[model samples]
Target: MSIMLKEMKAGDQGRVQGFAAGGQAYRRKLLAMGLTPGVEFLVVRVAPMGDPVEVRVRGTSVSLRKDEAATLNVERMP
Candidate 1:
């Protein structure tokens, strides 16, 4: 089953599907950060409070807030 990016924990891997809900600007921001569809990424870490989480994507690490990450639909990979 598909899951929201925010549901994943560190070491989890998944491929981008599409945005769940966001404005054009927000979506553009995600895309600019390399969170485009079909891209594979790893959940690198999550803050103690679980506010902002870091993910490894396209050879770089990007930090995204739970709200923003939640909008990202993902197909978890084994």
Candidate 2:
């Protein structure tokens, strides 16, 4: 099923479907953080209060705010 990036739980892995926002710069920023569409990522942790979420992508850990994370659409992996 499709879900917002911020909604992913710890240890959950998914492939990026798309970004909610449309813009070259926004896409570039996400790409810079290794969050390119079609790339797989694992949710590592969610900070208390859930403002920021940590994810493992391309062997690197990146933290993103809920707003930013929400922009990403992902599908849970088996």
> Tens-digit lDDT track for model 2 on 1-78?
788887778988999998886545466678789898899988999988887899999999999887778778899999
lDDT of each residue in 1-78, candidate 1, tens digit only: 778888888999999999886546568889999999999999999898888999999999999987788788999999
lDDT of 2 at 20: 80
Point out where model 2 deviates above 4 Å. Answer: 22-25
Q: Tell me the whole-model lDDT of each prediction, alpha carbons only.
A: 0.89, 0.85
TM-score of candidate 2 against the unseen true structure: 0.87
For model 1, give the 10-residue run with minimal summed lDDT.
19-28
> How many steric clashes does model 2 contain?
0
